[model samples]
Target: MIPETLLIEYNATLKTFDKDEIIFSEGEFARNYYQVKHGIIKMNNFNDDAKEFIQGIFYKRQSFGEPPLFIDVKYPANATAIEKSTIYILPKEKFYKLLQNNKEVHFKITESLAKRLYYKAIIASEISSQEPSHRILRFFDYLKNDVFKQEGKFTLKINYTRQQISDILGLRVETVIRTIKQLEKQGEVKIENRKVYR
Candidate 1:
């Protein structure tokens, strides 16, 4: 269902992208915020070695592009669709003005930014304090607890591969594989092909 508020204060724009499509590149003008009505979007950055590191992945009912637009800065990471996607575009100025007039909108934006910062701090803490396998396990634990629940032995969603998961967790693919195998051995998780079990 579309938000009536969005319809009144914003404009819906349909955008289509194929799998692995770059929706917006790093350093692009963040003139609008996007709402994902369907499909998935992954935000990634290139490391010093030029390997794309997945920072975050979002699915249906989620939104992105807010921080850069609100801060009046270029995007810090690239946004790519993991599959075919459709997004609703909300122009920054209109959105900002609406927020300025609506205390509820203002509070909601502030709350979202605070939650994002908290997640970033958690990621930094995990990188500093945990070993590779532990970090990957912790990452999966987080996904299970927050993103999806266990269904039998596997997670409900299969959004990432070992390599992409490793990149996001700052671990090597080999380490990710080893960690998952260990989980499977412990009956904590199972893996078939590249699908995850929990």
Candidate 2:
């Protein structure tokens, strides 16, 4: 993600939304670059049956909905506030200009987009070819190493709830619950105080 200082210096404005508020809907023109100042935002899609699938979650300081801005297209999915949140918004033209002027920031954005693409490819393979436990572990391991970046020999706290994990992994919540217990039994993960640890 780009630095907050850069966002501010580029004349980014702050916007706030309540929980469950839609920041932008699918098919809307991606006119602004958004960075989370506080709370969480989720990018999601719905199937014909109305089942929601989470594309990704953005935590504090993380940016969301960038591919459209770069590719000159509408948003492919909806972004919603998971809680009361503040976001820094940079107009699309200004955002493009800033990236043009900042080579390092552009490289960083490229790396981020590359990582997202890798995750999508891996998840797609998991969904098509792997078992439930393998899919869950692959996601947990990726989250630990890439997102959380944990290293020491201790329990790592996870931010996503089981239901959220299920949604993200395209599995049922019941399957997630059962799989988690199986993982605990295998000492792959721990369930302590009703919280998950990797």
Candidate 3:
């Protein structure tokens, strides 16, 4: 958490976005980091083939944009609000100052980065050798372990459509649908009007 004084000082400068609105674009200046106060945002990249790959779908109370901004590089992914959202934006210099003044925040950010890297490593590992079905299963298992809110039932802010999900996991939409149906048949999930309940 940012210090109370700092939050107050910075609170008035934040911005809000509606569903599907772009928060930032790839190759944009990395001058600010955003703290999500409400709703969800999806971060993704487009390959040379012009296909979008889902990198992450972050929910409320999460923060992103540090890695690129810290290195003073352009944003590597595009961030879009998946739902109506409010986010606080702190300029790079002020953010660094906040980190310096709050040791806990510094520790927390480092820990977050390490965890993200671990997940990225897992995705990379699977992409190298795993079949599409296995990859999707592993991805879902990861959600169950890390992001799911309950046992036996998972509710996620799935910002991507089936096509986007298919692209992310390198599976065809038909394959993704078939795999999802398999899961549904096994009572692992209930697919009803895009609300995946498990």
- Winner by TM-score: 2
Tens digit per residue, CA lDDT, model 2, 1-198: 889899989999999999999999999999999999999999999999998899999988889999999788999999999999999999999999999999999999899889889999999999889988999999988888887789864357777899999999999999999999998899888888888888
lDDT of 3 at 103: 87
Candidate 3 error regions (>4 Å): 1-6, 9-12, 152-160, 192-194
Q: Which ten residues in a row have the lowest lDDT in candidate 3?
A: 3-12
Candidate 3 lDDT, 75-172, residue by residue in tens? 88999988899988888877887778778888988988887888889888888899776777677777666665445565653445678678668777
Query: Which of candidates 1 and 2 reaches a greater lDDT?
Result: 2
Candidate 3 deviation (Cα RMSD): 2.6
Tell me the tens digit of each residue's lDDT in model 1 across 1-198. 235466355655667788999888999989877777889899999978898788788878677767888668899999999889987776777777666777776786677667667767877898889987677767776677655546454655556888988888887888888877887788777677668766
Error of 2 at 162 (Å): 1.6
Q: Local error of candidate 1 at 27, Å?
A: 1.5
Q: Once model 1 is optimally superposed onto the true structure by TM-score, how far is the C-alpha of residue 108 displaced, in angstroms?
A: 3.5
Reference-based lDDT, residue 185, model 2: 93
Candidate 3 whole-model C-alpha lDDT, 0 to 1: 0.77
**Cα deviation of 79 in candidate 2 (Å)?**
0.2
